[model samples]
Target: MRRSRTGRRAGAALALTALTVPLTVAFSTTASATAASSCYAVRGPYQKQAEKFLGLRVDGRQSASDCRAIRAFQTSHGITPNIGYAGPVTWGVMRVVAQQQAAGHQPNRAHKCPTDRGRIACVDLTRQISWVQDGSKLVYGPVPVRTGRNGYETRTGAKRIYWRHLHHVSTLYHVAMPYSQFFDGGQAFHSISGSVWSAPGSHGCVNMRGKDAKKYWSLLKNGDDVYVYGRKPGT
Candidate 1:
């Protein structure tokens, strides 16, 4: 017998509810606890990139101190295998962070997203950030987000928040998508039970941090304008 989508969602919701702390925090704590005693001495493919990102010496070599710092960052950011390897995923996340820093206080300095529409949610796929703006006033965010992966790139252009389900569950994926606000077709702004920086990106949905998603839920409503622009790095 096959399980129903509703049943699966119900199960996932129950499981999600059992968690005491935020998923990211819980994962970070767990990963830190289980991390290896000594950092891996092997040099990753992007060792120098990761080193520079972490403000360490760019020697292109993985030192013990470098490994510990990188591991700490990996654990905090919910990157898997937190083994201190400065691999592609680690460097990718670092690059996103750099862009985010550069975009601070003026996420729309480029004026890519149309500001004509009042109270619009702007998504910069290139920087992997999202912010809510009311005409010229910045209301919320400029928060980090994970967009769609290669084949499932998030569709760009203007849209509207058509529906919102507070305790939403993905019927197809059978996972808890808390605080979902759908703006474009199946693609919505939702909170996942993991780091927004997790690699390979989402399956078209714009994934947000728990706090950010909840804020979006409160600030946005049906009929609100949504504008998505730029291209994700890998896609």
Candidate 2:
């Protein structure tokens, strides 16, 4: 009876092992695909996000301003548009991204900024902004910025110098662009629109004093990593 019971126990264990093996393989395979898809999304985009990057109505008509807005944003981020920078890859991602707030998702490994070694430079661009000190170093820059309309929210993230215009110009603010260095998402480190002590302003780009902006502009280049944190310029 004891020998029979031992054989039955061994058979039950073997059956359980058979069921688990496929599950483990499936899970790992799925994880690998998800990672691959994410990289392709950021590097290329699908169709939906492309529209948002272009600032167009995903299914609606594309206006002249939409074209201009998209151009300006990309320029600030230091990206020379792709043929037109209007790739289908970007559009698909934007379509999936809701303008309204959703459950928070963490940054994928791709977005982390390099500090010191990885970062040859840093700046906090906002219209009428202030500087942050990490030790004796001025780790944060006082950036003048423009912000979104009623519901648009400026973002904070691991950033890098996307594009650097040695001597650039701006049309919206009716003056030469300050700092003129673009960071993530078409935002830049530039001069503030006006003189002020404190206010919540900007459509979500950094602002600066023309002279100070020029100083900041002199220090950066494309791909030098940094982080853009806190509010849009002056909070």
Return the top candidate by lDDT. 1
What does the lDDT come to for candidate 2? 0.47
- lDDT at position 40, candidate 2: 18
TM-score between candidate 1 and the true structure? 0.83
Off by over 4 Å in 1: 1-35
Evaluated at residue 211, the lDDT of candidate 1 is 96
Error of 1 at 117 (Å): 0.8
Candidate 2 wrong stretches, greater than 4 Å: 1-115, 118-136, 139-150, 170-175, 196-198, 232-235
Per-residue C-alpha lDDT of model 2 across residues 37-120, encoded as one tens digit per residue = 331112233333445545456743334444445444434433333222344423422332222112122121222233344334
Q: Write the per-residue lDDT of candidate 1 for residues 78-195, one digit (tens) a residue.
A: 8888889988888889899899989988899888878789999999999999999998788997999999999999999999999999998899999999999999889999998889
Give the range of the ten consecutive residues with the poorest summed lDDT in model 1.
Answer: 32-41
The Cα local distance difference test for each model comes to 0.92, 0.47
